[model samples]
Target: MTGPGMLTALWLTPLIGALLVVVLPSGARRAARPLALATSLLVLGLAVALTVGFDPGGDTHQFVETRPWIPAFGATYSLGVDGIALVLVLLTAGLMPLLLLAGWHDADGSAPSDEGEHDGGEHDGKRDRKKDDDEVGAAGRRAQVYPALMLATQALALVAFTSLDVLLFYVAFEAMLIPLYFLIGGFGGRVSDGVDRAAAAVRFLIYNLLGGLVMLAAVIGLYVLTARAGLGAGGAGTFDYRIITAAIGDGRLEIPPGVALLLFAGFTLAFAIKAPLWPFHTWLPGAAVAATPASAVLMMAVVDKVGTFAMLRYSLPLFPDAASTAAPVLVTLAVISIVYGGVMAIAQTDLLRLIAYASISHFGFIVLGVFARTEQSAAGSALYMVNHGIATAALFLVAAFLVRRRGTREIGRFGGVQQVAPVLAGVFLVAGLATLSLPGLAPFVSEFLVFVGTFGPYPVAAVLATSTFVLAAIYILWTYQRVMGGPVAPGLEGTPDLGLRERVVVLPLVGALLVLGFYPQPALDVIEPAVAHTVELVGGVR
Candidate 1:
């Protein structure tokens, strides 16, 4: 509301929280989670304040904070948030506390070992001692590391969302992989296949890094173009996004058609990979299944949004003509992503993987709305981003709760779960219903907007993408019937319902979905201006 200091604090608060967590005495290990939770809650409050101070119709970038970081290189520590960024910032902030809560005990487990079961009796005593030591050390490690990583994730993601500098966004985007890697590999749950969690983490990293490397080359090329045209901050190259966009807006610097396409390709490819659109999306299912539900939701709902948000923030504005030209092809890919993801989701036995594939389909809709470039489509795309995050997070987290009880992710292994834990079954049903974009739920409004908006410009793509309505219902309801309807499968009869802590974690998410489903106007009010600006930038047509 006041200055750039708040924006810096938006990230710095969590970073500082992480530092504080890492420094906690071993004896205070249990304090790490609550501390991280407190920090997240404070940030949520700050987000609320920022929302109040944010004038949607006012400046494009609100509460601007800029300082010279590398004057010679035309880079500054630039941070600002517009409507698109603001909503994403709010999403990141809002989800952190819930994620932390959902994952409260996730970091408590030790490195898995079954060696003693097969080992001879003579070494049983020795093996027991070794196991105890491992558990103790792991407990100590979990006391600080897991929560710290979550805080670090929030810190990095907030910076990426709020950044107004191309270099800053890229750095934050890539840095996200580090915490995510450990959150998945180190704290991840191994699916039934028993594939090494680290392998999944490695796959995620490699895919994203490759994309980032390509973008780096494009970043350099952009600087060179700006430097040659004398458009950078100094007389040299600048990574300032606002400066470049302003120059592009008034016709001061015109990127060559070929160069523009290449740059657009570089940025869009990176985003598509991050968005995990269709062919490049192979990594997400493994990574999501391997990680704990909290970790997986963090990646999908919060971290990956940066990819789509960048599409709006950087890719479209930076090369409006290139984006417009590429719209048809991108929309085609989005359609395939929708159908491909849904079919794959329907085929998944593992709970987390199903949710992962489902998310891929949801993203297809978001991307379609994005490149379709109509007023309703763009606005719906932005709104869909928020709703999808909420719905998916609710679904994944609730489903994971059921899986955790049964000690498996396989759908065949679960049955009539509602018979034992009706509350758990009920929450799962709500989440699943939201996932299918049922009417009177949060996803429906945004989804309807996406279809309505896209139909106006890309009728065929919209028609094909709407097939998700049936696909989603098929996957969601079929899975629901298999998992919750018939009879409680063996080993699950003693399953417990949602605990008080779990309720605290889940109820708010479910509430958000219900409220937003009926009245999405508040969020739409905060979102539309930025979407309008983006549509205008891309010439308001595909």
Candidate 2:
């Protein structure tokens, strides 16, 4: 049944699985992976059903559920999905199962065994010793913890995407960090000794919490203002997003210029750090490089979208005047991020870190589309969010397969991977091309829309940002050539091609990218109405 409660069920299914995993005996903890996979699959099914039932022609949110959450503050346990939310929810659901499979061995606390070690006379002993050390390190990690945390993170992301109440959205936003901190801190590949997982986790938590506290203050201030304006005179200052939005749009809630700017700053700052544009992005590369591929996918592909999503959903609509005032500054930063992230990606020797930088650049495009303030750009931004998650997840999953084989993420560690594993190499090539926005790939469609839409109004900014395409090609192609070309690395001759499980993990993403590339109409059909509505809301204030 496509009822209002379906959204809650979509997120809660995984949450319940996490709790079930928690109560499982230590001996049965291995079951946690399968349990998580099943739960994620169920959620995916529900999301697909929701999409089928969704009314694309409608401008309003569908399948909405609202209940009094905190009557004193006018916050409600409200949830709804428009086209933008629906697409992102689909992206989130689609990626989870693949992440689980890609990470199967890593999460289960197993390292590749040394059963077939190289027998070169002098180097054999050293290679065997290194393998032994790796196995020991892998065994020390808890099996249940990683999968459980992943499921929990998925649930929080769903809530964040669907919540309509600003307060509820904030709570979901902040609550997300808790599971993510543990995931990054507890499970992941190693970084240098000086920057342990704990340190990465702490840095991420501190940065996000600082943003959250600022946003909390802004939310409170808006509530008080609405109450004082007699917008919700009967009870606590209404945090009802619609009431506040209408009041702001109609010029009924008269905020002083100074106060509006402050409120706008608070919201933008939080999203900027989360979108991790330019200077605020220092934490991402370290976290992504150190995280296990599965963790990295969840963090970058799904979780980070919340930042740009919030910028579009709340920042622009809630404070249109402030957004207009700040658009130039925001666009400039986005252009810088696009170029900067691309250059950084070219210089990275670590595959995981390279992906991290690539995402920074991609997010730059998404944010630019958001602030460009046109229907096409806004829809493209939403589509970019979905497309990016798909493409990036494929890249991470394929890279994880390579790392599992070689036990290293260093780009220099391998040469001529195609000679040993042509299928894996092919998969990597497709993902890389997708990242660089190859035509007939999903990313190209959305990116083209963004440029077309932005160029009409911000021609200079759009032209500057287009330089990213060249930089992207250089980094993606160069990395591929370095890692997959030339003679096979000496020890990698025995490296196996992608097995059935790995293929299963990657094919769906590839298929989706291809299908969307050729026919993005379905997605655009869903996204257009929401974009039009947002444009209308912002226009009302103007």
Residue pairs in candidate 2 whose N, alpha carbon or C atoms collide under 3 angstroms:
none
| TM-scores, one per candidate | 0.96, 0.93
Q: TM-score of the candidate numbered 1? A: 0.96
Clashing pairs in 1: 441-517
Give a tens-digit lDDT track for model 2, residues 1-542.
Answer: 79768988988999999888767775676677788899899999999999999998864789898888887777888889999999999999999999988888675545323244556666677897887676654553356667888999999999999998899999989999999998888777554322367778889999999999999999998888988887764745787777788888788888887888899989989999898888789889888866778888999999999999999999998888888888889999999999999999999988878989999999999999999999988988999999999999999789878977998788999999999999999999999999999999999999998998899878999999999889999999998898999999878999999999999999999999999999999999999889888988877211
Worst lDDT window (10 residues) for model 2? 109-118
The list of candidate 1 runs beyond 4 A from truth reads 113-134, 191-193
lDDT of 1 at 398: 90
After superposition of all CA atoms, the RMSD between model 2 and the true structure is: 5.0
State the TM-score for model 2: 0.93
Write candidate 1's Cα lDDT for 314-339 as tens digits: 88999998998898999999999999
Provide the lDDT at 347 for model 2.
Answer: 94
Q: What alpha-carbon RMSD in Å does predicted model 1 have with respect to the real structure?
A: 1.8
